[model samples]
Target: MRLATIHADEGTQAVGVDLSQDEPRFVRLRDEDLGSRPSMIDILSEPDGLHRAESAFNAGRAAGDFVEGRLAAPVPLPGKVLCIGLNYRDHAVETGAEIPSEPVCFVKFSSCVIGPGDPIVLPRVSSKVDFEAELVVVIGKRGKHISKESAFEHVAGYTIGHDVSARDWQKGRPGGQWTLGKNPDSFAPLGPYLVTPDEVGDPHALDVTLSLNGQTMQSGSTKEFIFGIDELIAHVSQLITLEPGDVIFTGTPPGVGDARTPPVYLQGGDHVEISIDDLGTLSNPVVAEPD
Candidate 1:
């Protein structure tokens, strides 16, 4: 099931998008109507929640009205967002960095997340902003010390994400935490919608890419991931309790602006779209901060 959260007449509501409709139909769901409570974290904690929600949603759909806009991020606010660095082999090579022995994790504060078609703010403190088109794994349940073998069972769904970075801040500050580089407001634009794990045949095979002002920057497949999905879940869960709505950014492939012959970074009017098959595309405009 492709699920989403969107702005409805009733306010921000969770929805089940019936892909069966020619254009997806948004079926409204109240927090109490969810299979589990509306905790984005717990709903994904088990695959069963998705199954139950589907059953409940179908019956409820008959009485509600349907809207025709695209899907928004499944979880508008996660308590936390865990991001992986150098998880893609080529991405490491492009940066001239060494591959890590284990998944190198960092984070973006929850305030960073935005829905597709949102605006990416360019702060005046940093002149070099770049885009990293990546596949984002949205957690289903709470887990710690979970084995990778059981990890997939814990995932609720998948979606596209843009790990928009501030290159100047990342490499510039001496030991300044990467969160500063990564955690700018709305730096992470997630979802057009969350396509449940069952619908995406194999998370490892989907092709992902980013286009900036009509030109492609990052283009690679999830297959290129050094640690893959299960490994990422198992690795991170060991250190922290991952809750529902928590997202794992699986790193981007080569071809970022930083690696260009002469760096071509985002400006006030540049628009970007990151897309992965089935998951949906995330597009945002780059805007200069007002003086």
Candidate 2:
């Protein structure tokens, strides 16, 4: 089932689209046990909760009169948003980086998150803003010391993610880490909808492509990932506790602005669209920082 969280006047709420009826059906999940604040994150915490929500979504899609509209990201506020770098073989090659034995990880502040069609704000500090289209994994249940054998069981769903970066801040900075370069306002474009693990099947087999201002920039497949989801889970869990709604960016493919001959950084009013087979598409506009 495709689940999403739409931002309406009331607030962000869990919703599903009924393709058959062509309408929108909000999750009428009156969590009698948890009260009115039945947030997506809170619901995703329990393994059973995901199952129940999927069941509810299926039932609603069948029974309700569905309206056609855009779906937002399933998780509203993730506890932690961790990302992996250099996991894709072609991406690593294009960027002139070596393949790592272990997953290279990073963090993106939740504040960078924007809906699929939202505007991306290019920071004034860096003129070399680039885009990295990635597949984001949403955790189902909390787990620590998670084994690779059981890692897939802890996954809730998968969604398309655009890892917007400030190339200058990321490379030419004197910082100890890549935080400042990565975490700019409206840097991450997520959503369209979250497809359940069952629907997604093998995450590593999907086709991923990215376009900048309607020009095809990145075109690759998930098959080139150096470290798949299972390895990432086991490796990261060894150090920290993994919780529900914690998103993991499974790296990106080749063809970013920074990897070009002379480099082709994002200019004002650029549009980026990331498409992943089965999961759906994530599109957004890039706007320059206000003068």
Lowest summed-lDDT stretch of 10 residues in model 1?
35-44
Candidate 1 TM-score versus the reference: 0.92
**TM-score for every candidate vs. truth?**
0.92, 0.92
- List the lowest-lDDT window of 10 residues for candidate 2: 26-35
List where candidate 2 sits over 4 angstroms from the true fold: 21-37, 58-71, 175-177
lDDT of 2 by residue, 147-263 (tens): 999999888889999888987888887864389889998887888887788778579899999998788989998899999899999999999899989999999899888989989
Q: Give lDDT per model, in order.
A: 0.82, 0.81
Local error of candidate 2 at residue 188 (angstroms): 1.3
RMSD of each: 2.2, 2.2
